[model samples]
Target: MLITNQLGQVLVQHVDYRDTCLLPGGAADKGESPAHSAGRELREELGVTVPLDRCLAVDWVSPDSVSVPAATRFPGEILHVFDGGTWDDARISDIRLPRSEITAIDFAEPAQLPDLLSPPDARRALSALRARLNSAGTVVLENGCPLAPGVLDRIGVLQTDRPSYRYPWHPGPAPHDRTVTQVWGWLFAPDGRVMVLLEPDTAVDILPGGTPEEQDQGDPVATLRRETAEEAAARFTNPLLLGHVTDPASRRGYLRYAAALTEVGPAQPDPATGHTYTRILATPEQAAELFDWGPATAHQLSAVHQARRQLGLPRAARLPVTELTDPITC
Candidate 1:
């Protein structure tokens, strides 16, 4: 099963017998179905109970194609990979490992999988991940690469118009009074809806983002990750630099902005922002209307829509607002 945590990290387990890590599944027992076997293995290995009916991919592996030593290899096997759903921090912490079989279990990012798992296992995990993100139904994998078209292109570029902020600012040359740099995430949910945070008092909705600090070390993506965690209480993975926006009015400096497409995670209370934000999911059009910042917000959402189009995903619909709440801070 392809089990992932809220951070979009895949669950991999280390076995004492093997040097490479493995996905949290094993061969099915006699008279057991693939779904049942997946669930049972997860319970036995990670102590987490998640449904496995959402099949993501099915790979038919040949015995000769298996990368393991011939002595340890079995006949060709048909692997049924399921979507294990996203787990929150509490659920992740609740994972109980079988010390005898699984020496260690941790969620590793997709990019890190190559080093963590065996070659075949890494390919299988990546195929599952790509399927999960892009909603490619029943992906067929040869080794680890998808046999179908449009499943491999993951990164997307989104071009935005000139940066414009809400404040009364004008463009000027260097040595300007203000040089603002902000980072934001274009986080997408499994259902293809975009996640937005609503301001409690003003009721204006915005993306999960904020200004970078001195400690950010000049990495906008890092700032995006940190600020997103603080403001929206969510974690994301495979953040590709979609693009940046710069204020034309600022001659000396500009409001340097960067965004990335992220997989949506569990939402919690923002530890840094103090105020608990109201998390909402909406389509690009609905999101454009929700933003009180006017054209700037509209442009940002447009860029996101274009990115989605580039990824071969369906356009988001004009859906009603869905709110998930948390504790409020004074």
Candidate 2:
């Protein structure tokens, strides 16, 4: 079974016998349906009873393709992965682990799975995540490779290595000596989903802001407003300074801010790129997932949440991130 938390982190189980973490499930008992076995495994291992109705993935594992102990004859198997739903903090805390088989549980970020799990397990978990995120129903895989790969799968989202930048939030004003080279803002919709720009070809996530131009007169916020408008057709207000990350080589600060979106117009071509960016309203967690910031994502999320509270926006519900089809101005 594949389980996730409200923050979209996958629940991985660490067994005493394996070096790599696995999704919280075991082989089905004879005559027992896969869904029933999923629920049963959760109860016996994690001591939590979660519904397993939604099948997220179906994978075929060939016996000859995998390595196992000589005593353990590996019959080829078809794996059915059911969704365990999103667990809140309170529910996560209620989980209990047995001392023997499933020794520990971790809510791992999707990008971290490559390092934390075996190659096949990592691929399977990532494919499952893409299925859930895109509302693709269920994905089919053979030997952990998706048979019909989506854009995310082809781009190698979870399989890509992430860089660990120490983007520690600074409460104080940005240093006066350092030049502000670039500005970025998290433009929060009324529902709290943040607006981000995606590259037209690669679908690479980019924060909706850019470098300060001469027309901006060295104001970082002005740069933010201009870039947001050009790249996303978005207008926002009450910009709250989140913090800045200093580039040691350049002695410059990349300013980050959060603001409430006031209006979003129809998509238009950006003058700089000559391409209309693919605008998306992603949950803060989803933004983090797409960016793959490693551990620094927590710091950025904490700062964004604080700004959200200050701006009086409600906490965003856990919904699949959506793309604006025909945007309307507010």
Candidate 3:
């Protein structure tokens, strides 16, 4: 069974027998359906009664495909993963693990699965997460690899660890006492999808703005324009300052903006990294999920959408995020 918390972190278990972490579940008893077994395992292992109504994925492993202890040639097995629903502090506090089998449990980020689990397990967990996000019901996998993957799968979303920053957003004027060192914008396209730049090294999603260069002459809009052009080969109009946040670590203000994308030029390497970014357009909600801003994501996204409406842009359709391979050419 695949369980998660409100923040989308997977609830994983640690056992004495296995070095890697495991999602909560065990083999099904005879005459028991997969869903029933999942519920039963939760009761026996964690002493919880989480409903297992949603089937997220089904995986089939081939014989001798993966090695395991106490087996010369590993036999094949069919695995069914069900949703255990999101748990809160009260529900998590009630958990009672059978120490003889499951030793401990932790809520792990999706990107942390690779380090915590075996390759196949990591792949299966990530695929199941995408399946849950997708409109399609259940995903099928062979050797824990998705047979029909979506955009998120193809681009390897959640493959890298996200930065931990929960800076409080001040949706008002920038503090006159502090220096606004950085500027970032959610540049919206005519279709209402916002632009996000994928970092070359980490592939993490980020807005295409940066520190205000001296040449920018202390103009946040100027910084936004130059940064967007250099990072994404994109230009925008009608830059609207949403607000600013004071980074406790840096003691500098980070400005936020909402603008309408005007034109996209050919892709070029960013001067800083000397590598071209993988740019994509996502709905404001989707962009919020890509960032690890905690609750502040909703606040920024709300402001972005409101700015979008003010700019006379339509709400983006609910679809998979789109990769802009070459915005001008594509």
- Number of the top candidate by TM-score? 3
Tens-digit lDDT track for model 2 on 1-330? 778775567899889997999888888888999889989888988889976779989999887666776557467679887888888888899898887988888988777898898887888888888777656568899978889876556655545433334454555457999888879899998998888777775556678999899999877888999999998888999699998877677777778999999888889999998978877777887677666444556777899999999999988876655677576654
Over 1-330, each residue of candidate 1 has an lDDT whose tens digit, in order, gives 887664456788889888899988898999999999999999999888986768888887878887668988767678988998877789888988886989988887566787888777777777776566555467887766667634132221001121224332222222334354655566666556666776654444567777778788866667777888787766665554444444456632323222333434456567775676667666655454332243344455555666666554576654444554443221
Which clashing pairs does model 2 show? none
Candidate 3: TM-score? 0.87
RMSD of 2: 6.0
Flag regions of model 3 displaced more than 4 Å.
Answer: 51-53, 69-75, 133-137, 326-330
**Candidate achieving the largest lDDT:** 3
Q: If scored against the real structure, what TM-score would every candidate get?
A: 0.52, 0.65, 0.87
Worst 10 residues of 3 by lDDT: 67-76
Please say which candidate is ahead in TM-score: 1 or 3: 3
CA shift at 207, candidate 3, in angstroms?
1.7
lDDT of 1 at 256: 24
When sorted by TM-score, best at the front, the candidate numbers are 3, 2, 1
